[model samples]
Target chain A: MTYDWTLWIVFILIGLATTLPRGSFIILGERASLPEGLQKALRYAPAAALAAIVVPDVVLVGGVVEVLNPKLAAAFAAVLATQVSRNPWLPFIVGMGVLLGLRHFL
Target chain B: MSPSFREGAREGFRVFLPLSVGLIPWALVTGMTMGGVGFTPLQAMGMNVIVFAGTAQLGTLPLIAAGSPVWLIVVTAFVLNLRFIIFSAALARGFHGVPRAERWLAGHLLTDGVFATCLEKMLSHEDPRWRLGYYLAPSLWSWLLWQVFAFCGVMAAGSIPKSWSLEFMATIALIVLLVPMARLRPMLLAALTGGTLAVLLRGMPLRLGVIVAIIGGIAAGFAAERWQGAAR
Candidate 1:
């Protein structure tokens, strides 16, 4: 298959842009501190963004909310695993197991 | 184990273990899906190793499969990963004394999970070395597992069936991981704002909705913090 230079360029640009933020603050050193308020905001950004992505996906399947969806069931299992194991991997596994198992039933 | 190596290994292990659990299925699915879409195992693995961000990688898969322009794929991935900038800066503060080589290594290891775990550890611990280890441990595990799963998924691409329900499961996994972090009011606000904006703007092309959501969340969070500080 022919390699797409356009894709390669796009990927490189993306890589640079993605790396810039992470690298910028490091490169900047102590020249400036992130604004105190902005710092506070950053704390919640991940969770909120993630929730936005996850909630709808779990609750709404095929443009309809299905309370009995296995995805939600596995998600519940993951929450349990996270609480019980206090380990990140466990919840993910439990969730995956729930998903696979439920796949058979669905 | 010497203290240094022991710390490194421990840090590596913490990141490696749990991350493996989440990554295995995700990577496998990615690989399998890539194959289903016509990418070879080597190509899929290459993407995993090279791109290294799960969401962005997944986001670009369909585009790649559809023979979308390379620039579009790269641009989409870049926008999705812009948050790492904030994470890296926050982490750099904690690793001021780390050598350049170690810093680079740490950068490679840095991801959402490692950043969160390390941030918690840094807040609680004073030992730089231990802090480093604590941060590194889970990230290392996550990284290693991602590679293993990606490779396995690519190899077994044909065997793994696609289930739309599993997609929901993935979202749930992300939600479970995110809930504990929404502690502060500003954080809650940021999450709410970002998420709402994302949904509202989901129709925008090239995943620009995510970018808008991020900006909205950050701005809301900043305003909330400033207001709280003034009130105090």
Candidate 2:
């Protein structure tokens, strides 16, 4: 673990993960296909995975659940900004700005 | 390149130029996050050039920092990138009569923005002008912009003090990424359930909570979708 071989191995695994799944259909071409039900499920997986990662990041500080914090407030503002502007850039600007602002003030 | 390729390249660059702006903060943040996790700038850029996925990179770098199992890190990145499979399938079908080599190259280069642009211009258009040139230009430029900015982020993040919560930039980037995807009802349900379960299951070892939460979230979303279908 010391040479950071772990991260490097993870990178290789991730590279395979990236290329293999992406190349599956391209390589399979006209022969193989994913099931329709499975296809539907795939669409939601990223959303779920992202939420799983982010929720704790916001609610938990140093592995303890603490919702009343700058990150959560900033996350909420970002969520609201998304609805108000489809500009894509607005949410980050609003969210990060709020996080820094609140970290300063609160 | 040939005349057609040059034509496609020109159009690709033009269309891609606008979308390229949206990519700047993402690539830079990803690079910064690489550095944020204590990797040397070279290692940071190495991961960038190798993994080449923003979500997967942003998501898993934290796991590496957390000392989670290698398998867990790989699985998380794999799941985060699964959407690419769908993109690959659709991309294969949309652009007909492409050479086999080009298909391989295009698949490797494909990104969400490029996929959307391809669907609009190359896939549906059926124009001979929708040659490889049209697609490759944006794909390569997307790759190039990603590498250049990411490398820059790796270098820049080194200068910024860590107390600035520089890696929080990655979290905020993920937040922005997730917000757009959560637009649909099922998606919102999925995120909500996923987040809740993650909070409850936080005590799990090896960061297994993430996997459990993801599964729980997807199940919740599926149930909601099925329930909605019945209502309709």
Candidate 3:
């Protein structure tokens, strides 16, 4: 186990570094304008980051890409819900419902 | 809070409601994972309160468990959270003309979901109040819930059955968030490259793969946009 003091130090360091980047540009205010190209690239940041997170959760099992897990089906259901209803909440509901059912049956 | 700020907070909370469900499972799992690693409740909660980034905290837990040095742990978590720099820059644009103090607060509380919502509202020409309110409210909502669910996870550690598979909700949450953003060709390409690279690099340690994928996706998306512009 990490020493209590060591853990505290680590937490504080992590907190500072994480927040620094998050606040730096915002604090710069009107003094700085990110390049137009960079701003356009930032537009894709959400989609890219979210997909980076989602893919591993659904596709990987024991660090291997496996489609056998229930998450794959749930992902499909969620995507369909998003497409059909155009409601963000529906995908999570439908996905969870499908996951629960699949977990019970699979 | 000022009356307008209060109103903005309320609107932000309301808009974030849907995404909160997705956050619950992840927070619960994070708490439980902390407990599994023999962290005291105080330590666990302390980490959540201070290190507020869920992905970074979670990524670091495994390293801690393995007795990795403090430097390695810090570096890994830092890299994992590098995406927020991009978010902060983008948020600065969305929140242009806001007071410095308010912008500082927004920057501290920023998360990917809130940032995306704010960007969307800004791009659509919503009033400045709506934009600020929308961002602050959801960021607060998710932050509070993160603490609550994390504490719940610690208290109820090992109680949540694996069969519940609540963690999958995180992915589901991302799905809902990512889908709406994928309307554009560049967005789709970004998602494809990011998701594909993440899977391909899944074996990389310290969740470095996520950072790699994010960079790769952005590059692909940026190139795609430039190519389209040239053809036109």
| TM-score top scorer | 2
Q: Determine which window of 10 residues in candidate 3 chain B has minimal summed lDDT.
A: B162-171
Output the better candidate (1/2) by lDDT: 2
lDDT tens string, model 1, A46-67? 6555655655555556746678
Give candidate 2 misplaced runs (Cα > 4 Å).
Answer: A1-3, A84-106, B94-101, B124-130
Residue B218 error for model 1, in Å? 3.0
- Residue A22 error for model 2, in Å? 1.9
Q: After TM-score superposition, what is the CA distance of residue A33 in candidate 3 from its true location, in Å? A: 3.6
Give the per-residue lDDT digits (tens) of candidate 1, residues B56-125.
Answer: 6665565565465566556556645656767776766667655566666666556776676567555566
The digit string of per-residue lDDT tens for model 3 on A29-98 reads: 6577567766677677667777776787688777788888888888999999988895445775798789
| C-alpha lDDT of all candidate models, in order | 0.63, 0.81, 0.75
- Tens-place lDDT per residue, model 2, B105-194, is 777677888878876666565644355788889989999999999988899888977766666666777777888788889999999999
The candidate 1 chain A region of ten consecutive residues with least summed lDDT is A1-10
Q: Write the per-residue lDDT of candidate 3 for residues B1-232, one digit (tens) a residue.
A: 5566667667667777886777776687678767666677899999998888877776667557757667766765665566677777666666776787887787778776777666666546445666677687788888899999999988886565655654455556557667777888888999999999989987688667777898899899999999999999
Q: Tell me the DockQ of each model, to 2 decimals.
A: 0.32, 0.59, 0.44
In terms of DockQ, which candidate is strongest?
Answer: 2
Clashing pairs in model 3? Answer: B8-B133
**Candidate 1 CAPRI classification by DockQ:** acceptable
